[model samples]
Target: MNKVSQILVGGALGLSILTAASAADPKPQDTVDYRKSVYTIIGWNFAPIGAMMKGEVPFDAAAVVRHAQYVEMMSKAAPEGFTKGSGPDAVKDTEAKPEIWTNWDKFEAKMNDFQQEAAKLTEVAKGGNEGAIKAQFGKTAETCKACHKAFRKD
Candidate 1:
């Protein structure tokens, strides 16, 4: 290769390596920020259901179904390991307790149960039966409470 062409190729390779390294080594704060982003989306998706349950807003089955899909997606996401002393920030405003970090297995089981029950509730909502909606919604709420009671701080 000509001298100029060789230099150009070497520069390109160096740039690629730098890019890959940066991508692979995310900072701890960046990881915490990503977790918070996921939590925000999940909270937004759940807000409508909470409002409807409280009778503060009218229920929309289509909205519920869409948000349920989000919930299912989130539930399937692997839990991120928190950086030391980062637990409080990671779970800010979530009913999720620090115990979730301490009792990893139980926390994961509860999360799985939430996913399964939420999926069922989505299916039930699609059936267009008001009575069934009420029943399944109650069940889902209870599931949330069960987890909170065991794992959440007041």
Candidate 2:
């Protein structure tokens, strides 16, 4: 082959190998599983923040501020990670409920609302005002309550 032909063939071969590598990788379901693991980690890490917010634990503004990002992240994350059996057994033992799956539009709306509230809470917390944080925390908590009431198992 001419030099130019060799270069072209090499580029094509590299592209083909890249495509094959990606195709051999895990599918969306596997990706979903990975995201669920991340969600679990975020949940565990945020427990302290939750405790502080509710005053069960001592107030730690820094910790609350740090974990607020995870709340926003998990809230904004796609629901693919929330598949029927994707969570911890304690919280994940049951199906996500037929209503959640069947009425996906409403479920998604609630998720979006929660995400917005979390973002608002993060903003308020970042300002370092306990009063504002408490108020916004209430709003954020209400979002969780609303969604859980509608979609989560008792």
Best by TM-score: 2
Residue-level lDDT tens digits of model 2 in 18-119: 333234554444444555566576576557766776789888787778888888877766465566544333243443455776788998899899889889
Q: In model 2, where is the ten-residue run with the lowest total lDDT?
A: 16-25
Error of 2 at 149 (Å): 1.9
Q: Which stretches of model 1 miss by more than 4 angstroms?
A: 1-22, 81-98, 152-154
lDDT of 1 by residue, 1-154 (tens): 4323433554545663333323566555555566557657767877787677666888787877887677657655526534344456543544445776788788778767877877887788687665676777677667667776887667
Q: Between which residue pairs do clashes occur in model 1?
A: none
Give each model's whole-structure lDDT: 0.65, 0.68
Residue 35 displacement (Å), model 2? 6.3
TM-score of each: 0.64, 0.65
- What is the lDDT, from 0 to 100, of the residue 9 in candidate 1? 52
**Candidate 1 lDDT:** 0.65
Report how far residue 31 has shifted in candidate 1, in Å: 3.1
